[model samples]
Target chain A: MSNNLTIALDIMGGDYGPRSSLPAAVEAVNLIDHLTLILCGNERQIRCELKKLDALTHPRILIEHCSEVVNNDDLPSSALRNKKDSSMRISLDLVKSGRAQACVTAGNTGALLAMAHYVLKMLPGVKRPALISTVPTQTPKPVYLLDLGANVTCDSEVLFQFAVMGAVVAEQAQNIDSAKVSLLNMGAEEIKGHESIKEAAKLLQCSEHINYIGYSEGNDIFSGKADVIVCDGFTGNVALKTCEGIAKLIVHKLTKALNKSLFNKFLALLLFPVLKKLYKRVNPDQYNGASLVGLRGIVVKSHGNASKKAFLAAIEEAVREVERQLPEKIRYKFEEIINKNA
Target chain B: MSNNLTIALDIMGGDYGPRSSLPAAVEAVNLIDHLTLILCGNERQIRCELKKLDALTHPRILIEHCSEVVNNDDLPSSALRNKKDSSMRISLDLVKSGRAQACVTAGNTGALLAMAHYVLKMLPGVKRPALISTVPTQTPKPVYLLDLGANVTCDSEVLFQFAVMGAVVAEQAQNIDSAKVSLLNMGAEEIKGHESIKEAAKLLQCSEHINYIGYSEGNDIFSGKADVIVCDGFTGNVALKTCEGIAKLIVHKLTKALNKSLFNKFLALLLFPVLKKLYKRVNPDQYNGASLVGLRGIVVKSHGNASKKAFLAAIEEAVREVERQLPEKIRYKFEEIINKNA
Candidate 1:
């Protein structure tokens, strides 16, 4: 690897493609002193954006051209089986080949995951890679929730793996050494949940290294009672999207509410600064990156609809993970557990 | 069976016990013209609150005292097996004995459900009861979501039962004569989900009466795409609370954001009406009542922390359910479906 931390960017991915990715990559390079971004996409398109920014003179950014792009509608299997030269795959290859410390993508979620799994494999104890994202909590710090949409029907072992991975991320994101992990259940009861959740809770409680709190209800995710929450991907995905949808619904409803009368509209206009700040606080784009944890390499997935600023946040997330040497740390943690078992 | 609809309320339940329920009952009696409330709890305690409200002289309010109180810590099984004379059970007993058309409570959910099942029994062809609640949607009307926390591990048959029950509620609550129903899944794909959900989808698709749509993701609950979204209680409960948690987190975080500067605080004060309107629109307590559906009798469970107005809202929910004869309508729908199948 080069001396500077290198992050591979899938420039042709997401809705805006290079329009969003290139600007984010350029900004990221300027933000980190020793950072080099391997921007993977069509060279002509990349050059056009670089010319606009007069950034062709920048030594830190390199264009790694890939002809094919993974379309959002393309199945993950199609991307894995057919699109070998696609930017999403080529970018992951850079990480696997040690040319880059990490890879960031705003591509089709399923395709990126399938390609990442095939290219980098998985850590020793992890059967399947999990998708984790930071959620704002009532406390000063945000909590990490894992398996957001990765394993739809996670078994007991996979859920336990999520807890371990979530705990690790929580430690990295927030400086909590022993993050209290809890299984998200229907209720906060020993008798609640499907068999897999109950079984996972039993394992977590028995583990001495992790601070395993029993079961937490969905509300507890924001309650700041636990640093990490583990759940099956199906539940996690539903919960994540539901939160986003409700936020959107509230905004839409509020606009309608405010415009009901002329007095109210004037009141709302006067309150615009406060409302804008409130909107910024809960904006999903602000927390744009989700770590595809458990792969042998570090990969961060940005929201497909991420703005340039939001995409920059994702790039920063990848840099943070790279700085922490997240994959190696996870490997060491797994090895320690294995040694303890032996 | 009575000339006026009578709803039995367990007064000695919930966090504030008689304080919340008694005042709610009085408010409800004044709100609904032909409504009668049977307040079931300790006679002395009920009378004390009644005397304060001069509700003892109110012809619409009836006090039925029970000796025992069911604490929130009381397990469902313990409540069912031992606490037969507890206020929760006694209240349900009124519904069973044809004295009350419905029952309302702000008590421990598990105990209330278990006792209700034992006392009122299930409707024909209905194997289990599901907890149903109305959640605000993008549409003018709120959507009905079932099995909020009733059956953690629901089978295909149970999910189908939820559909039938949900459809009944939607028909009663909203104008759509045939409510479009969707099964909640991790994704919108037919391939995504646990086997039980897949099987439920198959059953719903084949059913003639139900306008069964394909799988809907978490966001669809607020998308106004479906009139009823049915899932296993665990998933539904998780999704419901996650929405509530995110709403709470946003409100909390927004308050912190606004107070950052005196100028911002002043703007917040100017925008107070807009903010208060937004808060009221998404207030959890405003939509406090969760109907326990698929039983022989209607029962509404209010949030334990419900304010007096919220508790009154729960009584209104019970009144609405009674006015429509929700249980009878569900019975007819089930019978029609069963007959069609046969």
Candidate 2:
């Protein structure tokens, strides 16, 4: 296995644990070349699952034993403090040392964030790590939204940094140059929102590091107006969840309306092919993972309820992130900006 | 025309102004029995638009002269101070002087809110007004979400009152009794968010005026889990707009994806019927208006870019609000709760 191709995976994380994680790991290993997986969890359970896939008994697959499991209900700090032998902690340690290039988990998000912060540490010039997700907008390319439920209380500097990091990811990972960044506000005016957003607008406007495209209201997020949308965690989290909720509602309503009468049911039958295509486009499960940005290494967080498909997507995302060397690119960008300013 | 059915409409409001307002007024007068409309704006412009409508000569219509107009860019306080002859100011005056049962406008939202607060005054228990809207969810019925874009900063008491008002509108106006009221939070847990939300949860937990259904996150807004979803104006506004943005993105993506190739183009032709039905189901123009709740009477706020169709929907919503006597029902509900506590 290549030295730069190792991933530390928390096998005892997520709702279904080995049932979902094992299949995803196998799929990822099969699809990607020259990759090694350092699995951290209950050794016996993992081996049993690996035994189910006879071909997985390769030199590239290594198991790191960890007895304790970080429960979903456990407080983040408590897991970090008490569960020293937990799978999440052991996987993070792999990334901390030279054993792994990145980490992937569908475990307790708070615990994962805290452990990554305590272990890998933030990159230089990065104040706090932000969670970034690619939202499929109407544009040809997806839009990147950052600080999604990461830091609820953020200042202008934090948001400004988020924009810089978001722009870097969009350019390197998404292969889009000159990424447009917009600050999420109540309105499209310079004087909207509370003190934090207003202050962020001013700082972003002055920063030569990013292509700050002034203010954008929530409606502009998916309107193809900006490539990178930055906001405080509270607002970003609410906005993201609201969009998901509404999409689900719209699909539900369409289905119900189509099934109301015999004539409508016949129409539904005729339109089943198209309706199925539309459903596939809007399903949340297709986009069920987020990446923790501004860290020294890649850390992809999958949904706790993620199935094998979702886990595979997360693993694929981690692979792309490592291949792109996103962290190093961000560091280089920041240093150039700092040197220019100095 | 019934003496109690007079509605003062801002004829010089909105981007289209009397062009959209006059036709909407005629439609309302024709649709609702015993309804009268007092058109407040420049008499000449009102007359010009009125002449376009053959039904403008009906006895139910009256024009009140107001020379000045509140431009969209005017500051709220400055507009109030400088334009005494503005349609917004004159309409509010009609409400204050008991000449009209309600005032509807598509003018500057800030100026309308200020005039609404200044002239109509808040109910005894409400600290500020809430902009409430009915969002059609996946369920057969529409859900009511309050503080859409009104009060940005809200305390526990204010949120509690918004919940009560939202529930009243859902039950009386929308005819959904036993309405489930939910406080929007980051998580469903009791200890989530800042102190205000925690306190609001406690108040809702003990509230008897509405059916409090515990805490709901942003993801639950479109799940039909709650009939009335309440949050501070800042979050509510962001949530509403984000939903709109995502809906537009979905339609845009579908159209683009369907036109990519010959086979897809054929598939698009096959699916056009169902897609058109779904598009109409989620169009914002069909639901383009919001009600300014906690007022002495119904005050509907239509979008500035509202076309004739949107204006027609707003007039229908106002007619329903008047027929339901939403203000009196809210008054009774609040008074009952206050008296019980006292």
Candidate 3:
């Protein structure tokens, strides 16, 4: 009801702290009109950065002082329990209390997920929340992959719900109507994977809510065969990480190959522009943020190593979620499906 | 004994006809010393291709006539039952009857696996046969990832044995004296994955036959953190496919960027050699074959679309299996582990 999109950001999260978060927040504020930010962290550090920004002051940027920090090595549950005034916890509380429309954090993923589940609660009929991310595909647009690393072990029902939720996100966020949903399987065959996936396939096949394309092999993910690829968190997590590792390896090898000799080095100099574009296309930071779906309030989890660009993108993603009213739409769809089936 | 390292190949298995298989067999024979081949397929087509080869008269090459071909579309069970005189069945029988040291197939992977399991039998103490494939790591050496697409659902005991078998293969093939084995998990923590991986991890941690390296994430697979990565076939298949898909996407994107403008095209021409070398390094054909570990007889399965190079590599892999006595070694190791634990 505030008439403006306000995002509560955990300024103390990620590797670079307020130095990255403040710049990212400022960049996001400048990019989006009618936007406000509540930067939650130690007030002194935020104020120091804010002083450096000579832009005309607007009431849009506010600071909520938080006294504690959650280090990466801290046990997620212990951190959530012990650090009551931690920046991440405070940011989530802001969304939960309706002080902010959405929450953005690059803190401990486990802690963020736990706090979100405890505070915002799952949507009706949603058993658990799924962390969904997008990877730029060879298609004309990006493909959204879900359950990236949220719940490692899930049943058929969870997978079916993930498929539905992923399709909804793709339809609203990526502007892809009738998003094709495919289950990630070992092979394209009907009888190629674990029991849960087979059961999920049966459910998805019967559902009219989605454009349930049949099974897709891993190679088909980036082939643009489907707009949304759904799987349990374990496999999805591994797939995402594997893609990242391979990208890094490719870049490292290319750099080494380029520097092997004088001719190659000169070629590298000429190819630097195109190679840089290609590298940016595959960089995880450019696509470093994911949304924790199935919760009552919007929560965006940025990568732990996220830089200014990635953090800002995460804030923009949160703004998009608020603008789209993703939670309300999700609720309406789930209700429609459940009532229709009933 | 024939005293020849002869292999019987199923010429009718893969997507292409004897066009690919026959040439591949000829190429394999040229590389392996004192090696012979029994090309099993329709009599007329085999003879026609054989006549095209200048070395057909050499004592090393022979042809086994098979009346029927196993179609990829045929059901695995039905193919095994009705295709009695099929090339795939006949080739397996050649290995079983001691007429050939091993059998190589690029046919229907399911039917090939079924035939190998039904005919050659499992190594003593191996409850299930695992399809172990080599993945080229960022390092100069390759990492052996097992249960790539074999058993979709496996118990803890089967995974524990897979780790041992994979370790042995990596040691023998990569010439690594101490093979480091790691269980692929969603995270590096102990409680990160399902119950099966957790139990498997406990068994592997105390395993005496292999160098157990605890847990590894998907990124660790390419970092050379472990020489052998063990997982259920479901996860392994997806992970491997994801890597393939991502690599292809990177290459595809690079191709696009390089062709965008004249200057980029010039750079591409200058860097063509290095780019080609990098492409060759990541090509699926370079790591094309999989070994059916835990089987009593040596069986190597190649990609259905394998070119002459991949087929030749499959033949070489079978030769290595014979030289290393992989099956016997696996049986001994499994028996030792079972006995000690019991």
lDDT of 3 by residue, B1-342 (tens): 424687899987787768888887887777676788888989788777778866567577788899988887777787888888999999999999999989998888888888889999988888999998887677888788988888997899999889989988988888878899999988877657889999998887777777998888877777877899999998888888887777788878887888889887777777777777776565553346888888879889988777777777888888888888888888787888878889
- Would you list the C-alpha lDDT of every candidate in the order shown? 0.86, 0.82, 0.84
lDDT by residue for model 2 over B92-124, one digit each (tens)?
899888888777888988888887887788877
Could you tell which candidate, 1 or 2, scores higher by DockQ?
1
In order, what DockQ does each candidate have?
Answer: 0.70, 0.57, 0.74
For model 1, name the residue pairs that clash: none
Clashing pairs in 3: B13-B107
TM-score of every candidate relative to the true structure:
0.96, 0.93, 0.96
**What is the DockQ score of candidate 2, to 2 decimals?**
0.57
For model 3 the local lDDT of residue B218 reads 79
Candidates 1 and 3: which is better by lDDT? 1
Q: In candidate 3 chain A, where is summed lDDT lowest over 10 consecutive residues?
A: A279-288
Ranking by lDDT: 1, 3, 2
True-vs-predicted CA distance for residue A51, candidate 2, Å: 2.4
